[model samples]
Target chain A: MRSGSPVYRRGAALALLVVVLIALPSVVPAFFINFVMTQTLMLGLAAATIVFLAKYGGMVSLAQFLLFGVAGFMYGNAALEAGSRGLNLGWHPWAAVAFALAVTTAAAFLLGALASRTTGLYYLMLTLVYAVIGYFVFAQITEISGPSGITSIKRPELLAAPVSLYYTALGLSVLAYLGFRALGRTAFGLALQGMRDDPVRMASLGFNVPLHRTLAFTLGGFVAGLGGLVNVWWNGQIDPASIGIGPTLILLIIAVIGGVSYFEGAWLGAFVYVAMSTYLRDLPLIDRIGITEARFNTVIGAIVLLIMVLSPQGLAGIADRLRRRPTRPRRPAAGSADETEAAIRRAQLIDE
Target chain B: MTATRRRLPVLAAAAVAAAAAVWVLFLATDTPAGTVLDEPGAFVVTALDAVTFAGLLFVAASGFTLIFGLMRTVNMAHGSLFLLAAYVAVGVQQAMVGKTRNIDASEVGIADWLVPMLAGATAAAVVGTVIQQVFLQWNEGQELRQALITLAITVVLADQMLREFGGLAQRMVWPGAVTHFITIFGQRYATTRLFMLGVAVVIGVLLWLWLNRTRLGMVVRAGVDDRQMVRGLGINIRLVFAVVFFAGAFLAGVGGVLGASFAGAAPGTDGAWLLNSLVVVIIGGLGSIKGAAAGSLLYGTVVAFSPAYLPSQYSFYAIILTFGLLALVLAVRPYGLYGRPA
Candidate 1:
């Protein structure tokens, strides 16, 4: 019944998905498990980053995928540079993540600052533009990155098993979510939310609105950077098709369907998306229905429309509301927590 | 009126776009490839290709800018809508000819007479309006919610399409006598392409007049600057939005139809076209027709010419160039090429 604080309930649900995901590689056949679990985790990371943008920053940047794409390329490039004898920059795969994260962070910092000035749909437009360019960069750059792609890409060292890679992705995603959670509670986080809902008032209060947004930009980048690395790691390669605008926007869809407002949204979106895409891939619905896979995008499109119409709050928001009513009377630690703890939790609710 | 007097920013944007175009041409000319870079004739051909590319891109982006600039709704479904319309238009072309759509530009001369190009565009508008009426009306000013809702719609539609249509890429074919190439500047090009370029320009001019000299355009501009204020002036904001949505969607459809005549509509066209439109609108200015035109041309030229000079392996160099340009423009001018300060 989720009979406790909404936080407890949410934690419980995420924990449940996590446990299921952890068990997947072993519990299910390796073939199906790897694809599903990896995709879910990657999207979960993407969606979590989006939550930071939506919940704290009041931004609707469509270009989260730009970070995702860049991060993937960074990973691929880092690997290639490390692996190539002529251009050796030897670092363990784990260490190479630093290179990728740094690039992603810098790009996010630069782009986010630009995007931070824009609100609502304008931000979305800028983000989309960034994504397109990122896609092109992914598709074109021969020496730097491109369509020919960075192949023969090996997985990171110290993560030997598919399960291990999945777990590292899972662990990092959790860490990122926690990082966002911690950040969302800081003086800066509060100031950013204040700006999100009311920038002029926050400015009147001398919060330096753009500064908080810039910090938020950095944080969002850091999280998305993690996603990019893991995404390439998951796919085991990089190419124009993988990194271009199409896949980038698709990642946005994954984040949105999962509910961009909270960390849970990412995992949820990943789950739904992976399940649906997997179903589409394995099933011969196109054959049975007499339509080609090229046209299968309608299924994704129609579902998105229905979700928009029927559940604007998304599955997570709806779950929270339901969790609030009828089942909240049973918490054991009611009123025992300090006021600051409650405030932090309340803020988490809004952001999440 | 006085903001219009502040013409420096607009001029600056023009300068930036011009500089980018020159940079691309310079690099393309310097490349070592024979067919790609050996001839002065090749650069001219490529530049023309860039112009056509920008023209088509402008058609895709104008409606997007209008919808976003005026109302702060980021319609993620916009791309899907364009893709859907293109798919529908291609279907129409195939039906009229009673054949599979090979969509070779070689076969397009007879198409003008068979189905007025306007029809496909009109169908897009109808679909756009219907989508707005049914899906978008209630979600008017809530950006994130709107984004999510539309995203859901996109996913569902994508799946439905895959189920209905096989994965094979389809094209809109032009039949018989119309399929011949029109040689311009001593290089062969599709006449349909020339027609498309003309159509895009004419439409741009007409749309400009509609917004500037016409009463409707004035209202739309006013609406963009301040929707609540426009309503106070006795305009039905809802109806205007519906119309804008229709026009925007219709343009996408027209682009889809003509686009099939060139690149062919495939499973992934929505994302590709959407990304290009986003770039055009962003570099230019959201919701500004002039901005979209400038941005489209900027992006179009990059698309046409980058492959000639950039290491073929690094072909997506244009994207980096775009981001670099966008970063520079946004850093210096946040409102895009022609967007007024908010």
Candidate 2:
């Protein structure tokens, strides 16, 4: 019950955050809420899938974005009228959403089963190849996606209003954040972390390492699918460009910049990314430096490089360090040293 | 049991090869309806085309594999380096001729080709060295982090190249000597492609000699096998890494120049080349020069021949076939044909 307890402080901060998010539409301009905030939440949720794999499962997959795109494409294909381009089974909106999620989850499960055979850099490359292959397939499949991709899929009435959509995105984000946090403490989560540390040891302990990894990846895919569902609703379209290399890498950049070690970092990274992409072109300094709207990627690249060099753990890591600094004097130096040693060991294990 | 397990992959590989041969023979004959090949000469020409394209792929992928083998860094920016060189070569040729108009291949001399090749290779080597020293040097052994950093570099370099060189595709003016078609096996083939094939062969031979016949090559080999042991032997591993990076980037630059003369270079060429390099290295085995060659040949053949042989209705599936080859290879041999388990 102590006011100074870390749990109490965290709880209070989370409450304030919830209240602010709930009231954000009233305070902010409609454009900000609709364009920026909603996009941030959706992208954040997508990035959260990446964070979950990287942080807990020790797998940095480039295919999460592909899954997101798949979900969006599936929904668009299933819900849109047959008159529109691409396959349109003309299912109900809710059915389409469910179908999209289920397909995405299954795809992720299959991808994980295939990719889990390898670890570290091999896994990364395999997933990247998957994304690239997915992109090419989507681009060429005119029967399913058409040349330009499916478009004009109307949002369900429940989410037609901008405010409702915004709140839905926000609610989903919160649910995902809490879900990941809680999952991280579960037996399955602990086993995944164990596999991340030492698959051999986990295997000897009777854990089916590949199955655990695949299950985790499937969970991540479902979250990404949720994000994709909102994304299509917000944008009212799905195209090849949505899952192109640029967007694929951008999602990874978001996950890394936010801090892959923490769930909240996904949202934090997404907010920064959305803000910079939306406003960097308008900045006087950017204009002076000759960075046009098209060259915003350069700015983002520079920022990501800076983040990697200066704070490898990302903005969240930097925040954590700053928050812990004031309390460091009271804690034993051995504790910090031990933490660093553990981190080093974890990195080495991952490299193996 | 262990011996049986060890023999399994070889058996699988042989089976795959046999299946591929059967498929090729099936395509070569008139058994399939609407076959593109009316004569055996056409098939020979297509096969030659596939091999030449593979030559370009090997040139591009060799450096990537070399870099990956030594430093364990994926070097995603490798494709950007290729595109950069292509653009630079094009610029140099454009500037030297002092004309924006398309220069005929016959009008250009040795210097026209030589100068751009030198300039492009030099530029790419310098950039590669800078990347290794400035960005990658501080973060050694952290392969994933290094990969992300290179990815960032790719974004910046790709954007900058787009800014400097317009989005339109451009190609180099080939030297007059290699512009004509040469008769091979009673079929006309582009001499430029034959020249490319020759270049790839020469480069491969030189690389083989460098790796086997020289002390530096031995060090590189040892470093690839066990970097820590090499370092512990009092070798300056960082310098070796830098040299490998330079050579690898130089090879990519050469590939760019050669590729520009053949397929041309464009905005999205970086991603395409990157994908090609990835597939080649993955199939051939990462960090193995021989694997790259084998993988490139397989990949190039599939890409070139599939479209021609596939029915007109399903021609687009050729791309899928190329990727399917990768999937098949991965399923049989996870580390790749020539790759050792990390």
Candidate 3:
């Protein structure tokens, strides 16, 4: 993924990162492993969807949660449950998951078709309106989600335990990250970036801009669908609050704060979000200031504003700066080495 | 002249047809199994309620539209400003109570109400100006970032307001004389609504005159059309923008004060009013005074009638219906009725 001495360093970093993540459960406290990491993975997937669309499609979709919600609702409807609500079909867990994924992907494709026709602010507004409409439809229709919520979902044997569930979620997220990386190396991904830069030019170059955008949106939706599965499984219940603007905004805050320019920023942002929400409210200083959990949004909002103003590229940008720091001061390398190393450095930046 | 003359009959016929359809729908859906004229009278009550609601909404939404048209920035914090103003009104009224020991605020003189209203408006205007100067001015051309910044401001403001105001719903007490109910079609209605309606008309006329007849209004209109030209022409565009923002915020404050007198102020009022104002501006045509007025009336009427005419279970559908209408309008006319395509 890199060249020269830096290549070894990056490889070492990647290996370290992998080791840390895999051993996190055993190394960290149960609270951190069970709650923080689990949330970070799931929420990261959702945020990554935003990052994908924004980075490649140049569109900010506020309705990504609709896909998540649709999947959750489908899972709720099909999964095993008690009570006379009759909303649940009590299907096999695998079957329910499949059905939810299929429906969510299809719905996302349709929404993508409608939304991709617009650009800029109109697209943002359209997606926002759609999300609001989706919220109302899901909330008002008691038969779908039930009056209260759908609970007591049957998890498959492999995914029954919390630790196992966390691992499964982590595996899926890693697979998704790898899949996205693979996609980014493809011709379609290159064309998608070209489209984001200038749609008219891409269209002139024989790219179907709308189709490209729709495909990206669909891919993003699929990733979000996976997150929805993890989310529903973790909670063992689904409700409007899970899919509403509040949580959606939280995801947006995470994505933006982490930095949308890079895909890994999604996970980084989610980690910060989960950590802040999990830990910030209990702090003595915050408690003394009377900032209860109810007023938690204030802290998140302030952080978002600070990040937007100070570093729109977010934590990823900061990480990048730190990575590039040592290289910048070592400009006294031999002239021949500099000439040969230029292309490799450029390749490294793009690959990362 | 000939075209205008020819349009009169068509307009009249369309009006008649619309009225007939409304009457038919009202008779079919709203009439209870036992009541005859009660439902029809209730329609009048709802209509009045709608008009009053439209009046208050117009004040807030027109300001929102004005800011958007001129600056090309969607101020998400407008709702927070409205809520802030409402809280200010409530605070002012409470302070009045402390000074005069007036347990029954409705018995107080007109100055008691006027001072609070003025304070709310002034506070909102000052805050709006500060926001424009401090936060919005740097990111003038970037719409999405600016919108997010405003959202952040909104969230922060909302939290602070919630902390200070607590979760309770606070209402401004209107003068006792205007608070009295009058019988209209056997339905008791407050005279305060009539007063509010009068205020709306006066504000509308004043705004029209300001925009059309005044130098600043002319400059604002010009700026909306071409900001660069206004800047190049040696006009103080920044000052004009600041003034317009102040006026817009002042109107929101007025709306908050007026609404608090009837609807009361609560924690989520900012989000609700922001959504309502967005719908109004989107429907009415962004940046158009007449459009804001029309959109507000339609939205208000829908909100008022849906709850009254539709089954109680579907009462919440009023918001959905308004949104659906906006969607339809947007689908057909993406720029809104009066809005120009970008």
What is candidate 3's lDDT per residue for A229-340, written digit by digit as tens?
A: 8888888777775676566667778888888767788899999999988998778887787678988888889988987777666788678767787655321111112122
**Residue-wise C-alpha lDDT for candidate 1, range A249-321, written one tens digit per residue:** 5677766565556567778888887887777756755567654455555666666566557665456656765
The residue-by-residue lDDT of candidate 3 on B197-274, one tens digit each, is: 888888889999999999999998998888999999999888888999999999989988988887889987887788
Candidate 2: tens digits of C-alpha lDDT, residues B74-164:
9999999999999999899888877766798877887998899879977988899899999999888777778889999999998989899
If both were scored by TM-score, which would come out higher, candidate 2 or candidate 3? 2
Predicted structure 2, TM vs. truth: 0.92
lDDT of 3 at B58: 95
Candidate 2, clashing residue pairs?
none
Top-down TM-score ranking:
2, 3, 1
- lDDT by residue (A160-239, candidate 2, tens digit) is 78888899999999999889978988999999877776666676678887689889989998899999999999988888
Q: After best superposition, candidate 3 residue B106: deviation in angstroms?
A: 3.8
lDDT (C-alpha) at residue B115 in model 3: 95
Q: lDDT order of candidates, best first?
A: 2, 3, 1
Q: Return the interface RMSD of model 1.
A: 10.2
Q: Give the better candidate number (2 or 3) by lDDT.
A: 2
Task: Return the lDDT, model 3, position A95.
Answer: 90
Lowest lDDT block of 10, candidate 1 chain A: A331-340
Alpha-carbon RMSD, each predicted model: 7.3, 4.1, 8.3
Give the per-residue lDDT of model 1 (tens digit) for B213-272.
Answer: 988789889988888899998888888888788877777877777677668767677777
